[model samples]
Target: MTRALISVFDKTGIVDLARAIANAGIDIISTGATARVLAEAGIAVSGVESVTGFPECFDGRVKTLHPLVHGGILADRRKPDHVAQMKELGVEPIDIVIVNLYPFEETLASGASPDECIEQIDIGGPAMVRAAAKNHASVAVLTSPSQYGDAIVALERGGFTEEERRVLAARAYAHTAAYDAAVANWMTELADEEPQYVGVGLPRTATLRYGENPHQSAWLSADGKGGVANAVQLGGKEMSYNNYRDTDAALRAAYDHLDPTVAIIKHTNPCGIATADTIEQAHASAHACDPVSAYGGVIAANRKVTRAMAEQVKPIFTEVIVAPDYDEDALELLQTKKNLRILKVTPSEEQRDITQISGGFLVQARDQVDQAGDVFAGWDHVAGPEADEQTRNDLEFAWRTVRSVRSNAVLLVKDGASVGVGMGQVNRVDSCRLSVERANTLGVAVESDVDTAGGAQAGTAASEERARGSVAASDAFFPFADGLEVLIEAGVKAVVQPGGSIRDAEVIEAANAAGVTMYFTGVRHFAH
Candidate 1:
């Protein structure tokens, strides 16, 4: 009779598979829990001890370490020498080995002690699996419970096809791969070694609808449920991949607001960000920053999204809106947008950042928040027009937003609203030029008096015609005065930035000479 051995950690399909194999007149040889489970299910079985004529030893670690198990699994069916050797050793030919390793991933995640995790590692199981997979052309290998049914079906059909065998062989390797990676990760964490097992245990969160656009495929990586994954839906529809990306940006910007704030993001950049006495005021300021970009953007309120807030937001074309809580009417009003994704989540505390490597994971706490006051190793330009209370607060706000942006980033915020954002440039100067260019191209020439009477949905040039005055934000300390000169030429009248460069006096002198107001936030936010 053909024979198979079965053992598994994830017993997803063991009982039915064991029955099917037994019904095909195959002897089922198992060890310990595998045998007990089979016997309880009323299936006939041969225990490893009985087959090998040796009892399990060393706290069951030595259960399957016998010639009977290895000889049968490793024997090459086409080689007369191998078959003769197995017969000479009184070993019954084992046609299949279905085994899975211990739950090391689960144990590690459970905060298990080192000893507990070490004990859960499976040695004999991997050995048997490797042996069976190596001889897969003649013997079937089933390293996972998920593959049990397929293995039995092939046997019942008389023999496994070459393609079928190769597919199972590949999966067997993957099973071993995931198993080894888990153990390595836990040990690495215990050793406190950076990159010890980076990229090891992170699971793919989902295959998104598409990446930045419809052509590219994308997936999300998140700690399952309660982290980024468990944000609630207060209203609207499912988020596409791009929506998640932009919403995360908005959340980070909202968090940077030291006061109760609101932020709106489009395509992973801040179009609007503000802090104020209420969510409504903050939202309005943020919206005014770039009302054109605010359309179909993601908005996040640091506090609860209120009814009044919802009423004001209802008129815009928003893609997603997030907050901690929503009043009854607030939720109802938002529900009207069939495709607007509404998420309720605690504003993310600046505490977690995840990095994945080729074979493991690297986790770290968020870098400290850099607030604007005097964040430099050396504060430059002090007492050179101490920032007005409004400029000072705006300085802090600008610093927070700048840090969340890409390196070589610059933002322009005026009257508490983020007006222009320039990111991902080649250098600080390039970023400065880009910010000024963006403002001039979009909202640079203040036209605050442009007629909104034509309706809020009015055209862009007309809208830019309405905004008056210019303000700017930079992500890092200015290395020289030229960057400030560029902004002034572009019509910017105020500046906010982390002022740590040694030449702050030069930049300050230049700004003062030009009659432009500037503030030092003293901190920097660099996402890279």
Candidate 2:
């Protein structure tokens, strides 16, 4: 009779599977709890201690680690010498191994103590599974409870085919690999060691409809810590992968502001952002920044969603909305849209930024430069008129908003709100021109009424009214004076940038000649 050894931490579906395996005329050998579960279910089972003739030691941690257990499972049925050696040792072959490791991942995540976590790590289980998997031609290995029923079906058909055994062996190896990886990752975290081998555990969360496009295949997985995986979908359709990416960006931008803020992101770039006393006002101000681009974009708020805010956003076509919480009435109102994904999640405090390169990943700390009140305390007023208190506040706000934009970014802000954003341009001059054009188009530009001044021809009255007093923020210093000239022609009153370019003097001279206030932050904000 073929003997099967079963050891498992997760006992889901074990009793039924054990009964089926026993009814197939196979001898069932299990250890500890698994054996008790099988025997209580009226299935005749042999305990490991009975098979090895030695009791479990070290609080059962040493069970199933003896040579008798390993020799039986690893014997080569095709080799007469190996079979003779096993027979000479009075060892009955263990034709099957049903084993799964301890729940180390869950134990680690549940705030367990180091000692408790260390005790939960299984050594014997992985060894037994690997041994059976290696000798798959003569033994079968089952790693998951999901495979129990199929293994029984194959046993009822006079045992599994070579192909079936090979597939199960493959799965068994992967099971042990993932288990070991989780343990390694957890131990690394506990020891606070810079791991020589870094591994990210990405258990599948969902199979996305497609990746970026329908023709591409995609799947969603996470470290199982936070972000969209933990977000509560109050209502609306399932979130797509792209929706998660865009919402993540929007939430980061929204949380950057201390005041209640709203951020609208499209294609991973912020098109609108604002802060106000109430979420309603913030949403309205952010939407007014670029209503056209805000359409079908993800909107995130750093505060609770109120009914008033829901009503204010009802007219716009938004794809997703995320917030810390949503009032009951606000949730009900937003649910009426049916297809808008509304997610409520407390943003993660900190996370590493990861980028995939040709062969491996490049990991670094997240860009979390504090955007508090004193961010501009050490900034240098390089040239032109000094920024007054109000203009300084606006410049700081614009700088924070510009940090979320892609490289070659230009942002215009007035009254703690982003009026226009130019991003993903090839040149700083184009970014400046794009921001000015957008500000003018959105009626956020100051109406230009003056003739030629500072070698820049002003726009009409409407343009001057919107752009005249707005402060501009560049992610990096201007390489030439032409980009600074574009902002000057748009009637930009103040400029903030990281001053490290060789042409910093020329850029400062242009700002002074144009009579525009300029501040050097001395730190660059470049987002790709």
Candidate 3:
């Protein structure tokens, strides 16, 4: 009679499968708890130790590692010498292997100790599964409990075809690979440095409609826990690739603030960010910062969404809204916006920043500096007038906001809210000019404008007037006085930047001459 070796960690649907297999005249063989389960169910089953004639030793770890178990599964029925050797060793062929690995991922995730986790790692199970899979032309291997019903149906109809056996074997190999990758990743995470072998096994968790654009193909795979993959789509149309990117940016920006914060993201840069006493107020303030750019933007809040907040968001043409939680009424009201993708994300505790290039990828720790504490306590008041307490607060807010922008970035802030931004410019002075122009477009209120424009330039005077009283933040030091001059000419009140440039003295002199307050944080935040 054909023999089927059954061993598994997850016992779902195992008994029913075993019953069907046994009723077809196949003998069932199991070890330890699996054998007891089948025997209690009135199914005659042979213990693995009985077939091997060797007692399970070393805390039952050596039970299935015997040559008898492996010899039977590895033998090729088509080879005369293999059949002769199997008969000489009194070994019967194991036509099927039903085995699932130990729950190592679950054990590690549950905060288990090293000893507990190590003890749960399987040895003989993967060995037997691999052996059966290698000789799949003559034997079949099943790794998942979900495959049991198909196996039973195939066996009841007749023997599994070669194609079926190949598929099962391929799946068995992939199962072992994913299990091993998880273990490797766990070990690497515990190590202080990169291990000799770094393996990333990200099983495809989602099949996206397309990549950056509709013409390209794309998918999302995650090896670790928590991220956009785990976000619950409470309602609305499917999330597109760009939607995920923009939503992540919005959420990350929102997370930077301690108060009830809301961030509006366009493309990948945060167009507006605001913090207030209530979530509704924060959302409204963020939207008001840039109403024109807020169209079809992704909005993320760091607090629970109330019905009032949902009602506030109902009028805008938003692509996505993500938060920690939402009230029942809020979710129902938000669902009325048919195409708005609503997501409740349980953000990951450990964040790793990843960037892909042409050849390989780069991984680094996330830059999540604490922005709530006293960031300006040790900074130098380099030039111009000393910043007052309120100016210092707004300066710090602008400093933190510019940290998220791309390199060559300039941000204009008023009252802890971004009024204008210019990012990814090759020239720092150009970025400053672009920021001033954006502020003028937003109609930001200003104080007096300097006559830096030649011969009564009305447009330049109006632009500089709108940028007056706004603080400016630079990701890096101003290499030349021209960049600081642009902001000073635009009527900026104060500025913050890392003061390590070679021409730092010239820049400070320019600020002092123009009566613009300048402070140096002594650290640069260059996001390239």
Candidate 4:
């Protein structure tokens, strides 16, 4: 009878697969819990201990590594010498090997002691998988319970061909490689060195139908180390390759702020970001920032999604909504929009900043997030140049947004609201122009939305009221007054930024000259 060896951590469909194998007249061999599960189901299973004559010792760590198991899996039926050796060794060839490795990723993520994580690493299982996979021309290898049904079905229909086994073999190697990578990553992380670079670590979670385009294919892998940024599937249809890229960018922008914030992003650039008294307020401000650009954009928030915010979001057309969490009410509201992909990525313990260069990986510390606190430590705002509490709050938010934006960036903000932005330009003045144009396009009040909303109640000059709702911020020091000059003309009343240009006095003088208030946080935030 053909022999099948099964050892797995994820017992998703083990019993049924074991039963099917038995019905197909194949001898089932399993180790530890897998053996118990199969035996309990009245499916005959030969334990690895019995076959190898080596009792599972060291609390079950030393199982399935004996010559019997390896000799069975590594034997080639087509090779007369190998077949003869297997018979002489009294080893029945393992025609099929089904194995899933230990939870190395899970153990590392559990905030467990180092010893605990080390203990979870399965040496024997991976060895058998590789042995069976290496001889794919004569053996079938199954590593996941998810693939068990398919493998059993293939075996039932006159067994897996060389091509089928090769596919499983290739996946098995990738699985072991990815598993080893995660363990190596965690071990290396215990060291304290940023100058030295290591490698990336992740396990394949799923394979997408295609890549960014239909012609290409791709897989969704997760850094199994659990934390806020671990692999997460919030909700939505199968994510296309484009949606993941755009959604990731949006999450980066959204998480930039320590405060409750929201950013509407399109094609990797942020179209709007706002910090309001509440998340709802931030969303309204962010939505008004570039209402036109936000259509079909990806939205990300720093805080958990609340019902009120979700209600407001339901009215808009968006491709994806990403946040740390979604409240029951919010999730209920969002569920109605079945096509909108929801992504909930909490900060994960295992996070690596990775960049692909040439043919390898460039890994670095996650670019740190700096909080905009005490930045203006002892300096008065150059006398007569100061910001109020509300203005300062908005000022800090604007400063952070500028750093995340493309160079030659301009960010417009006010009262915790983002009005307009112009980014990725060759000249600062062009950024200013784009900011004003986008703000205008969004119908953000040239002055103040608060006044417009209030003035509408009082039957006053709504046009003037609306325009007062905006402010402008710059990413770098203003090299000249030209950029601020352009912004001031666009009806930006207050400006906030890092004050460190060669012509700092010149820019300050220009602000004072233009009768606008300017406050310097005394620090520059530039992200490249």
**Which is superior by TM-score, 2 or 3?**
3
lDDT string for model 4 (1-528, tens) is 389998888998989888888888899888889999888889999888889888889988899888898999888888899889887889888888888988987777677899999998889988988998899999888888768878778867868877888999999998888777767766776765543546444556778789978889888775644332353666678777677777777777777777788888887778778776567667766776665677888888989899878877877788988888889889989989988888777754324567778988766556443444554453337412466677666666777677667777888876666667788888888888888776665534322323223221222221232325466778777888888888877777778776778888888888788778887656555544
Most TM-score-accurate candidate: 3
lDDT tens readout by residue for model 3, 1-528: 399999887888889988988988899889888888888889989999888898878887787988888988999999999999998989888998889888888898788998888877889889998999999998889888778889889888977899999999998888888888878866776774755554556666689999999999988775455656678899999988898888878887888778788888999787677676788767765665566677789999999999878877887789999999999999999999899999999776655566778999887767776466888887899998989987888898888778777779998887767777878899899889988887777532222221112211112222335577889999889989999898988889999998999999999999989889999988878777
RMSD of 2: 5.9
lDDT of each: 0.73, 0.83, 0.82, 0.75
List the candidates ranked by TM-score, beginning with the highest.
Answer: 3, 2, 4, 1
Model 2: residues with Cα > 4 Å off, grouped in runs: 39-43, 145-161, 189-196, 371-373, 384-389, 443-465
- After superposition on all CA atoms, what RMSD does each candidate show versus the true structure? 5.6, 5.9, 5.8, 4.3
Clashes of 3: 0
TM-score, candidate 4, is 0.84
User: In model 3, where is the ten-residue run with the lowest total lDDT?
Assistant: 450-459
Model 2 error, position 338 (Å) = 2.1
> How high is the lDDT of residue 334 in model 1?
85
**Per-model TM values vs. the true structure:** 0.74, 0.86, 0.88, 0.84
> In candidate 4, where is summed lDDT lowest over 10 consecutive residues?
454-463
TM-score for candidate 2, please give it.
0.86
